[model samples]
Target: MYELKEREMIFVFTGPHGAGRKTVAEMSGSTLGIKQVISCTTRPQRPTEVDGQDYHFITAEQFNEAQAKDEFIEVTRVNDYLYGIKNSDIEKIFKSSGSIYLILNRFGAETLQALYGDHVVRIFIYADRDTLEQRMRESGDSEELIATYLSHYEDEMAYREQCEHVFENVDLAHTVFDLTKTLDQYLNRNLLELD
Candidate 1:
């Protein structure tokens, strides 16, 4: 059976595209010494992103083959691309870290929550639509792709109520500070319960 160690936990970062979920997750994870479980995606890599660091960019065939082999713990299709987290990746992180974070969509977060129950913490981060669009534009996304992302914003925002924590990511530094503090409290509480 799959199980986390007493100190291990999974943090799922979820929100609409360009909501700063990845930024917040990375910043908080760095501050808290939590590793990030790099996910595999069939989307084309951006010029600024590193292949293995940002994501495991794979071909559609490769993604399908891995999914067929039951390698992914959760998989979701968004904007005509596939994204998933592999079971092995989580295990690999746990070998050296007590906690890990995953950048996921609403569906992916729900899947992990169902699988891990209390062991998974779901956090939803969001920004104003204008901010979101500007972020996407700054990231070099095409206008069409940005529009496609925005089209799903409402659906993504609707999931915020289901998350254990929600933050408006207008200011990155402040958001990261708040997130780190909250995560620390959660981890401490879990430790107390374990004892």
Candidate 2:
């Protein structure tokens, strides 16, 4: 028997590279008026990124401190980098609205769902392999790397079933409209007002 709880939820989204899940999640979070649970990372700051805008861009020492304190909802190593979404960010989002969204890796989504139960709504984003490769090339990665990454898609295909929703990010041109529609449905409202 399953009982539904009405507490605030964590709307998590995951996808393969160049699928635009991160962009869609950010837009959805902004539209919903909740903090998007931006993570802290050990990766170097990119040219367009501020100290904390894109990521916390912390040193290994700082990240280790927070990790030791168990301050993160999920933490993992990805692409030779340390990435973590802090519990404080989750608390911040929940404090403001009836629901919160976290853009996470597939692993994080599963971990959070296990801990939060029905409070976690997972969305898996997908794009055709060719389109994904094209987008990755446009984003400046080498073709070889893009091909290597795309090869993993087949192995990771089963992960999509783990999510509550599977979004196909085909045409990048109309991504906003599609994302907005999904958010509206997920929140069950045309307008989401943040507290």
Measured by TM-score, the strongest candidate is 1
Error of 1 at 103 (Å): 0.4
Highest lDDT against the true fold, candidate = 1
Clashing pairs in 2: none
Local distance difference test, each candidate: 0.91, 0.75
Local error of candidate 2 at residue 40 (angstroms): 1.1
Model 1's TM-score against the true structure:
0.93
lDDT of 2 by residue, 51-149 (tens): 766688999999999999988767878767899988777666566577777666777788888888877788888887888888888888777778767
RMSD in Å for all candidates: 3.9, 4.6
lDDT of 2 at 33: 67
- TM-score for each model: 0.93, 0.83
Residue-level lDDT tens digits of model 1 in 109-184:
9999999988999999999999999999998889999999999999999999999999999999989988888999
